[model samples]
Target: MVIRAEDVRRSYGETVALDGVSFSVEAGEVFALIGPNGAGKTTLIRALTGTTDAEGTVELFGAPPTDVARHRIGLLPQEFSPAGRLTARELVAYYAGLYDESRDVDAVLSDVGLEDSAGTWYENLSGGQKRRACVGTALVNDPELLVLDEPTTGIDPTGRRDLWRLVERLADGGTTVLLTTHYMEEAEELADRVGLLADGRLVTLGSPGELVARHGGDSRLVVEAEDEMAASRALESAGYDLLPDERHVAVPVGPEEIPAVVEMLEAADVEYGGLVWRQPSLDDVYVALTGTDVTAGGDPIEGGRP
Candidate 1:
């Protein structure tokens, strides 16, 4: 195992940040930890990096994450702010000195698509470019494990895809990664396995598809109709199921029942603008297990997100 954490617990006075959480990460695997804000995801990451006090059996690189093991790990913290005055190259070079080693600063910069911005001052870079620079700093040491916390939070879709590709390429080359994200799509797209955390506990753990399958068994058919009530009643009368929403009626149907539901809608002359079938996803899994949306930031699902 690249990471082995068992019964980990952390507390701050009256508040328990991590409550006997346990999980493991295999070498060369991309494992994602997802939870709402204040769910102790950051607390666990801090403990694993040996930056905070905690009670647990935690190991990295098959040993305690001491000075030696720490050197083999690269971290892109959620709140990263490089020195405003330093150029990208200077930032990476400074980190290289910490490892007491020399690295191809240019290569690391280029790997993260930052070669052209090597001379740009860290504070002047765009949000995505700054993120890229931070990533370069993390990679200069060529560590065995990479830990990222919300690595692409503010990046645009195209830049986000580029970063995703880079992370995937790194894993393909035998680097183990552990990440925390609010974006369920990122977890579904990049993770071989995902662990859902809530209120300092490991709620569930499994492959993305397995979690989705375990939590969501029915396909959802969403219809947009001018008269949603009549359409809903027609489907309900025909024994089609209604999901838990009112803006647009969603019917729960199996593969074989899909055609039947469509035909029934047509025959009943229920005017629908469009119909779409949505498969189960990690978003569904999270909502099912936590009873709240990932973007809800630990609030009850009905409490509107801020």
Candidate 2:
């Protein structure tokens, strides 16, 4: 195991930042931690990296984080403030100089898609560019284990996909990755396994597909109608399994059953604005487990759970 944590606990005065969290990450596997704000993700990262003290055991390569060689690990905190006056190259090179052996500075910049912006001052770079620079700093050391906390927060869609490819390449090359992101798609795309944290607890842990299968409910056919009650009654009467909702009436149906549903609706003369087919995804699992709904981009909508 590249990482092993058992019953890890941490608190800050009145707030319980982490409540008995535990999980493991294997070598060359990409593991993602996902949850809402104040979900103790940063605390767990800190504990695993030995930057903060907490209860329970956390081992990296069978050794305590502090006992492990620093050159073997790379960490990018959620909030990093390198020297603003330093250019991107200078920032990455400064970190590279800390290790006895490191990847070439130019190569690191190119890997992060920042080669053209190498001379740009840290403060002058765009939001996405600054984030890329920080990622470059973490990669310059060429560590075996890489931990990234919200790595793509400020990146554009194209930049985010580029970073995802970079992560995929790193994992293919035998680097163990532990990342935390609000982006559900990021976790679904890159993670071999995902651990969900809420209120400082590990709510669920599994592969994305497994979680979606277990908690994502079912494949839903949503009928957007002006009269939801009538549409819901029509579907329920037709022997379709209905998923309760406040707005659109949703029916659990297989893809092949969609035409049958449409036929039934037409026979019953039901009026619907449109019909949408949605497959179970990590986003649905998040809502099912956390009692909150999140947008595709991972912004939480603060409402009662469905």
Candidate 3:
């Protein structure tokens, strides 16, 4: 394992940030730490990078995280404030100088699609442009392990797509990447494994497909019948659970059940609009494990209710 954490715990006075969290990352893989805001993802990253002290075992490449390890780790923090007066090239060169074997500054900028903005001052660039510049700085040292926290937070959709390509390329080059992002699509696209944190706990961990398979259900059958109450009652009698919506009836049935449901609807002559079947997605898995919608929240760091 390139990175490992065992029984990690951190507290901020009265609030427990992380409680007995544990997980590991293998070499040449992309691991995502996903959760609602305030679920301890940042705290966990801090612990792993030795930025914060916590009671636990954190090992990076068989050694404890320290200043030497820091040089080998590329960290793009959630909050970044670059020198406004410095040009993109200058900023990258400054960061490169801190490493023993620094990557070519122009190459790193081009890799992040910032070649055109190399001369632009940090203060003059747009939010997304600045984010790309920040990413370039993180890649300047060619660190073995990359840690990105909300890397795509301020980026636009197009910029996000570009960043995704960069992330994939980095992983393909045998870099172990640990990413934290609120973008479900990004996680779905790049992560080999994802860990969900909730209420200061590592709630679940598995491959994206594994987590989906473990929790995802078949298409949701929504029936809007002429007599909603009667239809709900019929579905209940047939072992379907009642959802919050009164006019809709849902059941976790496979393709075979679809035929039966259709036949029953025809036989009963129930007036209905239509039915929709959606494959269970990562969003559904998040809800199932955390009992809270991923979108129900304030800022990206302050997650929704438990």
Candidate 4:
């Protein structure tokens, strides 16, 4: 395994960040740690990288997480702000200097799709470009393990896709990647396995398909109704389940059952904007495990970074 955590726990005064969390990552595997905004994802990353002292055992490449292993595992931190004074090339060169065995700075930049921006000043780069530059620095050491926290937090769709392709290529070339992000699609895209964290606990752990199969239902029916109240009455009467938030009613059905649902809705004259049919995903899995909307009801633990 490239990374391992056993019974990891972190506390700040009375606040508990991680509660006996344990997981492991294999060589060349892409794993994701996903949770709400303040559910201790960042804290866990800190512990794995040896930036924070938590009570538990964490190993990087079969050794304790310490300065000796720091050079072998790269980090693109949650609060990554590049030094404005340095250009892209200069910044990567600076990161390369930190490791005894480092890849060429230019090669690192090229690997992250930043070769054209090598001369661009850090402060002058766009948000996505800056993120790519940060990734370049993380890749400079060609570390065995890459830890990325919210790597595409504020990036546009195109830029986010570009970065994802970079990460995919890295993982395909035999680098182990561990990341945390609120974007479920990103996890769906890159994670070979996912661990869902909620309120300082690992609620679910499995491959996307496994989790979805275990917790997720069949095809979901999403209808935007003209009248929420009437729509609820009609759907519930016809044996379709409604989510707590009725703005969009979700029903579990197979492809053949879709027509049955549409038949009922049409019979009731339910005026809907549209009906969308889609497969179960990580979003549904998270909501099922947490019993709350993934984006709702989260306050940071005391002394915890958001």
Which candidate has the highest lDDT of all?
2
Q: What lDDT score goes with residue 84 in model 4?
A: 99
Q: What is the C-alpha lDDT of each candidate?
A: 0.84, 0.89, 0.83, 0.85
Q: Which residue window of length 10 is worst by lDDT in model 2?
A: 297-306
lDDT of 1 at 184: 89
Give TM-scores for every candidate, taking all chains together and pairing residue i with residue i: 0.91, 0.92, 0.84, 0.92
Residue pairs in candidate 1 whose N, alpha carbon or C atoms collide under 3 angstroms: none
lDDT of 2 by residue, 239-306 (tens): 98778642688988888999999999989888999999999888788888888754322212111111
User: What is the Å distance of residue 1 in model 1 from its true position?
Assistant: 1.7
Tens digit per residue, CA lDDT, model 1, 82-200: 78999999999898888866468998888878888899999998899899888888887888999998888788788788889999999999999999988888999999999998888
lDDT of 3 at 110: 94
Candidate with more favorable, higher lDDT: 2 or 3: 2
Instruction: Candidate 4: list runs displaced more than 4 Å.
Output: 236-246, 297-306
Task: Please say which candidate is ahead in TM-score: 3 or 4.
Answer: 4
Tell me each candidate's RMSD, in Å, in order.
Answer: 3.7, 4.3, 3.9, 2.2
Instruction: Tell me how many residue pairs clash in candidate 1.
Output: 0
Which lDDT tens digits does candidate 4 get at residues 180-277?
Answer: 98888999999999999988789989998899998876667777888867878998998777766435777666667778887888999988888887
Error of 4 at 235 (Å): 3.4
